[model samples]
Target: MFQLSLATVSHGAVASIPLILVAPFALLLLLIATMPLTPPRVKHLWEHYYPHIAIGLGLVVAAYYLWRVEGGGTVIGHTAHEYFSFISLIGALYVVAGGIHIKVKGESTPVVNVAFLAVGAVLANFIGTTGASMVMIRPWIRLNKIRISAFHIVFFIFVVSNVGGALTPIGDPPLFLGYLRGVPFFWLLDHVIGQWIVTLVALLVAFYVFDRRSFARMPVRLRHESEAPDTWRFDGMMNVLFLGVIIAAVFLPDYWFLREIVMLGAAVASYRLTPKDVHLENHFSFGPIKEVAFLFIGIFATMMPALNYLEQHGHEFGFERAPAYYFASGGLSAVLDNAPTYVNFLKLAEVSASTGGGGESTPAAEHAAVHQLLADRPELVIAVSLGAVFFGAMTYIGNGPNFMVKSIAESAGVRVPSFFGYIGRYSLPILLPILAVCGWIFLH
Candidate 1:
């Protein structure tokens, strides 16, 4: 990574450059070229949603540039792989519990939907947001299909998809990554209580107001159908054990490889022991996890050089030199992948601290820098974790499992919002403000 940074700095932007930044253009061209061959339904679904495809491909370009300019060998790449694989296991647990449902009915009335949202919030910590999203989005939509509004889906993406996951390691990928790196499983609880409480309260309040509006506008037929049973019931309760196994895998990652093997066998055994209807009726497939597995493999493979370079050289950029850097790093991560960005900034701080401790940095200078950095740690962790988990709601590609949720929901006949459409509607109004507040508290 050092070598690329040096080259980029020395040679300027033209150094070893390709013509026309072909990566993104090429990706665009390829996607456009494939339109003719694409299935009609897929083409129709994606033509409007092309921005997501374009951006996913653009990430490849960004990775290449970072790799070419930064000189890290494979560290960043490996982290992406490990992180995704870990999240996937967590996602599987959500699947088993049938926890990933959407709040379709009573979205207009808080009384009916509050229970669903509450369950989703708690389940998010246990199963991960990706898990909760998959399980919930469908049911929520199915229940409320009679009353279709952009906000319905947008709200789902905001609260259930992002905010609900803030409290635990398993609730968000960034937090889970923190856990694997030695942040205690429950440490986040201590650090983020203020932010979580504030955000949670804000979410509940917003949900109540919005749901009341939605309910008032709901059709009478739909309203009657929604009232059949406000009381929730469970089926295939045995799936909770599968959910537990997934959590055990996350909390006990050292034994993950072994645990995965055991769990795979167990899931298969359980499938056989149970009635066929449970698996068939749930209509579960490996599609969500598999999409994440593949897309993230690319992200992992490509981001290596960039992450390594950031690790070594980021301090010189003068961002982490203040509390502002924490928010800056975390905010940028909302647009970029958060894992490498977190490592990059964290490493930069650690490196600066070490260098300052030595005579390499003057004592007076060292004193100022460390103190500035020291004060930032609380906010820094919050910035990174909050940005990674929440800003991800900004776009489908912001996080691994987002696209899967869109794809699955579409397959089930519920159209999802477009890339910019999603951000403009859902995140901009709801999540963005909350996250902006978080950024303000941390950065300012």
Candidate 2:
């Protein structure tokens, strides 16, 4: 069944990392997942000191790599570069999207809400889940302000911020990493579009059920107020140019951080030029992005050891079936940064495919292995790709846009579930089964 021998793959300096180094990442995730459930004073302390906690944990890992491991500085440097690129794109999108305000004056019936989410889902493929979430979330809240609840925010993350972006490289970061690694631009659209539609439809239907209940619970007068005819006014239309610049900047050469520079420049231009009234209407602030930025520093840094461990040992899990890869990659993607998780699993799939005799230990060989896997076992590739993008909605930390959407919703006085509450209430009970059925039907 195996095509290539695992011995052909190189572990490099990452092989020397001890399992103990994973503690920092684990600790950080635990804190993030549970802190909000703590007592009021404790939760307040966590909010006040989260930046220091996150950065301190990140520094610990950085110091370990700098002082202890061989060739580790290079790994840390690459991670830093990745982190900078990540935050730059996210921050730029946040700033640019924040400048454009969409005022929705209309009814927020279940059908309208579903259509809105469907549109956001489609928009996610073009502008990215982060961009789509930033641009669409406030409007969503305003549309549903009469009866918004935690489920509204959770379902928004499900449809718009994560699963909606499975169709294109621009839709999600993990897919872009696949594109960079030689997957065809339309590979996902070709292979997984059916499953994408199925999953999206399932989530949307589930959302409609919840929303119908929510709509019914509203008093008759409030329901009438929410169901009134719809009108939308656009403000800060000039920011669209800045958004286009940011999106175009994604394709710029990575040399000297040109992409990040262009993105940030556009963001600064948008922030400075946009009217104060638009910002006021949008209730834009730096708080949500600031929270995402500092926390992700810890997440990206501490996750290196976990990712490294997976890279060095992933094949031993004996994942011979597409379903195994689906759940394994999806399970990890739910917690770790799914971009690197997707890449590592892609490598594992490549290694698994090389057992039939075409294995080598070079960068070119690795690239070729990806094509080989694509040509030979495309199902595995689809499974991994879907797992990474789809399961990213399973938790607040699962995707960059998830937390940002939550923060934005909370800032607007919408009720949002706590981190664990998000999983226990919506992810496990609602989202997981839909994803699982999709995986079984498609990948199994």
Tens-digit lDDT track for model 2 on 219-306?
9898888868899998988988987898788778778999889999999999999999988877778987898789878987987766
lDDT for model 1, please: 0.57
TM-score for each of the candidates: 0.71, 0.83
Index of the highest-lDDT prediction: 2
lDDT of 2: 0.81
Q: Per-candidate RMSD vs. true structure?
A: 7.7, 4.6
Candidate 2: count the clashes.
7
- What is the lDDT, from 0 to 100, of the residue 94 in candidate 1? 44
Alpha-carbon runs more than 4 Å astray in model 2: 1-17, 176-185, 212-228, 335-376, 403-425
Q: How do the residues 1-444 of candidate 1 rate in per-residue lDDT, one tens digit apiece?
A: 113322232222223334334335434434443553467898787556654665476466556656664332233333544654564555456456442222332433456566667677667787677767766766766656666455666666666777678788778776765655545677677777677667766766777787778877777887776667543445566666766776676554454366556545545545555555655645667665554444444444434334334434555666443346445655655565555455455545644544432122222332344345545554555556666666666766555556666765677677667777777766778777776776576456
Evaluate model 1: give its TM-score. 0.71
